[model samples]
Target: MKLPRSIEEIRSDFPILSVKVHDKPLIYLDNGATTQKPVQVLQVMDELYRTANANVHRGVHYLSDIVSERYEAARETVRAFINAPKREEVIFTAGTTASINAVAFSFGERFVHEGDEIIISGMEHHANIVPWQMLCERKGSKLRIIPFSDQGVLDLEAYRSMFTERTRIVAVTHASNVLGTINPVKEIVTEAHRHDVPVLIDGAQSIQHGIVDVADIGCDFFAFSGHKIYGPNGIGVLYGKEKWLNEIPPYQGGGDMVASVTFEKTTYNELPFKFEAGTTNFTGAIGLGTALDYLTALGREAVAEREQALLAQATGGLSSVSGMRIYGTAPGKVSLVSFLPGNIHPYDAGMILDKMGIAVRTGTHCAQPVMDRYGITGTIRASMAFYNTEEEIDALVKGVRKVTEMFA
Candidate 1:
């Protein structure tokens, strides 16, 4: 069978792309939940475990020096990947969840006051919502929501109106996981800055789609997971402005985060180390670095354009389906489609698609507020990466149609 030339070339780099489900060819379209790992990232992790394994930043041995050097170099790669101002501004976390939780505790402890409000959007993933809720409950602060329209675009005017003297911070998703709505985060940041409030962008869904310049966005903090960008799990990044990192307290207490420890008091380490507590996922960090390297080599702009074509093809094909109610028809969006067809439950559709070796996510997608806003239990979401092809999208459309017919 002849495949599309570009994606065929790109797909070979990912070993899992060839996987089969139920004795049928696997058509992996669940990039939003977590992207598939590339062989390049896996090989880097494997090489580390094989020959150069050692605890980083701890010992004077040769292996320690080697591993520590590679680990810090990986931090520098991430620093450049997002165009962060300094390496010290990059802090490794378990994933996006842990990164947001870090800011919730540390940023909240330092800046938030009772009766103060923090702004977020209705389209945010639960990772963005629950952390602030916890922070609000702990501090007696309030959570203010910037509502979206039926099309899943944030009401920018409502957003501006929501701010008040008591509004201390704004947390938002750069792209909605379920909706694929690419937010105007730079504009959001500029608006927040006028009120002297800092904004944190959850970049879990946005980063893999294209380049994300924290410097360009001017967001105070950004968080994303490695797995969302073809890297290993158990690794994520928190990119904070230097001022915020300096002002916020440590999120956890453990080794390496301290400069010195006394029985009475302890002086914490500075900048990135101050926020990073305990032995982190060192191998995973290396794997993330390799993934970033892969992206860099491929050039994010080229990858983005490829995915855009896939998005257009998928959207056009899926729209032709009868009774399809596609969500988040923003003029600008990443490569994903979320929809419900003709009173069909998303779970039922997803199960049928799976038997045909098509992987899709169904239900709330961890953004229950979005579902509540639309009065939907969930949606069947197919998120694509640059490696996917027009053929795969055609397959997805066919699968959805089959499900609809099956139900009919």
Candidate 2:
């Protein structure tokens, strides 16, 4: 499970790793929020802004052509990265939230109706849950939740039984952000298809952790944020099957989304462009492509192994601390742990950890339903990435213990 390059060499790619917060080295465990970008992604984006800054697909000038080529090339990169069946299936959006909204609006308008049911899981982030709820409200449809167990595992039997002729679509997360559970999305897709329903996978947390093949997973739509994977912010990908993309109407209407416009009739553009209305984030897309290339070079399998080792170290160290109660103990989960240190409020403990230069998220983490399920307000989350080290894990353990004692 050795990395293709030395860990120190890999760490050097991200300059922020060397920073000192509160006079202690920053132990960034907030990777689930957004990953720190490497210099490669930053440099490419800066280069684009400096040299070839132009609106894509709208100009015939030199700069516009170059930027457009690079922008569309980024789409190919996304298609290859996810093993999508076609390049036109990849649509760039603001982020995962926007991607889901596009699907919810377009898909719901086309297919959902009164009394139709939308199925989602208990572990879904608000991004996944809220959009479907809004759609259900608009169409008089019902939102059905597939509950998870105390161990954070979804009840597959319940999910299968819930499906009926009324079910319209099934949307779920490939992994749980709060629970750190890697769901059986392939199986979930298979089961949904059995009932003639399509599935959408929210890959915001799952994309950077391991290999993702939408073709293999057999999902109709896959959405993820670039910033979650060391790419630029305000950029994301929504990969839809070609058939589905063509079937659904455009999510937006603006310049490039229309092929030809008359006062009376306007024909929408084809596949990917139909969804990308205004000026697309060409620089962000190129930067995301660079980030994907960087991950490809690093070897996703090795990166997963490295992160798993870090997760193992973190889980074991955190578990040994007295009065520490860890959540999301599902087997084969990703490299994150959410826990409460005794009776300490998560924010209080998080503040102490921050002074020690450990950055962890202390909140419901945009998954309030999960917190309600556990009957708690929030928990402290330490999410790891491949660039993290075992030393950082140990430092976090010591920091948490200090926070616990201070609170006590």
Candidate 3:
């Protein structure tokens, strides 16, 4: 598959990719945690801080007005990127963790009651799992899990049978961070809607890999982190349907989320702002918008193709090693691989790889349940991005071989 631009050209956009570690050229394969930001995103953020730094909304000053416009424009960009029906449906939060927690609190308060059930898959990151678990504990509800196969595919048949009248909402990941499984969320949403259940997709891992159309998936809510998509840290988008946004209470009681405050009572602001309490991340939001624009210009389809090619290469190269055990072998996974080289502990393997200037994620990867399911403690994971190259994949293979020999 052809990339939208040359690999060198695309890699040049991210300055950090050129940096060395331990006197060796850096080969970063940790995109699953957070992607390196492009210069375009960095420049926009720097420019905003330099020229238009100010608080957003309800300000008469020139800096505030300009910054506010940019901030709201970032919301619109997020709305468009996710293909949400209304711009007001988009809410900015600290990141995916914050987004999921906000929904758990607000949506739980609005809908959940004693004995109610919430359906989440076994492969979910803690961000998706714990909030629901907290909500269940708070509301005297039960948290139901959808089991996955040994191959890392969710049991849709079991998922369909799990919903009941007491079911409040269905929360699932669009892609598994550890498994790299690209779940059939559209079908999952359809099944939930058949039961009159609303669905929330954790898009933190999927958004950076491919197109994420909320309308197409038919999920009622979606959450993703900006940093995972080559944007600034501490910014994320939560897209909720208008009906739900209107129904749920504000997540926090603070400055911008209020319409008025009286001694007797306090009224809340309108949609979007209702969820955005206190001071907003206006500069980070603008930076995220620039990052989205940069990704769009690169052509998401072509980017996906490049990443898939890298995934294939990594999978093949890693599989050839003796005593290698890959954890997630789903057929249509994203660009990541989780594995153990023989009985070698993941932490030891990771340290050796780091010394060789190859960066990879180690341990349970925030998905301890996934590790438990496989009867292992943790795995060394190499996650790829569009900027990653074939040479890097080859290097990773060689590094793993070295790790295996050292342990032997």
Q: Score candidate 2 by lDDT.
A: 0.95
Per candidate, the number of residue pairs that clash is: 0, 0, 0
- lDDT, candidate 1, 1-408, per-residue tens: 222345677789898889899999999999998998878998989999999999988999999899999999999999999999999999999999999999999999999989999999999999999999999999999999999888889999999998899999999999999889999999999999999999999999999988899999999999999999999999999999999899889989999999999999999999889987888799999999999999888888888888888999988999999999999999889999999988999999999999999999999999998999998899999999988878899999999999999998
How do all the candidates rank in terms of TM-score, highest first? 2, 3, 1
Candidate 3 lDDT, tens digit per residue, 89-160?
999999999999999999999999999999999999999999998998999999999999999999999998
Q: What TM-score, computed on C-alpha atoms, does each candidate reach? A: 0.98, 0.99, 0.99
- Candidate models: Cα lDDT each: 0.93, 0.95, 0.94
lDDT of 2 by residue, 63-104 (tens): 999999999999999999999999999999999999999999
C-alpha lDDT of residue 275 in model 2? 94
Q: How many backbone clashes does candidate 3 have?
A: 0
Q: List the residue pairs that clash in candidate 2.
A: none
For every candidate in turn, the CA RMSD to the true structure comes to 2.1, 0.7, 0.8
Candidate 3 ranges beyond 4 A from true positions: none
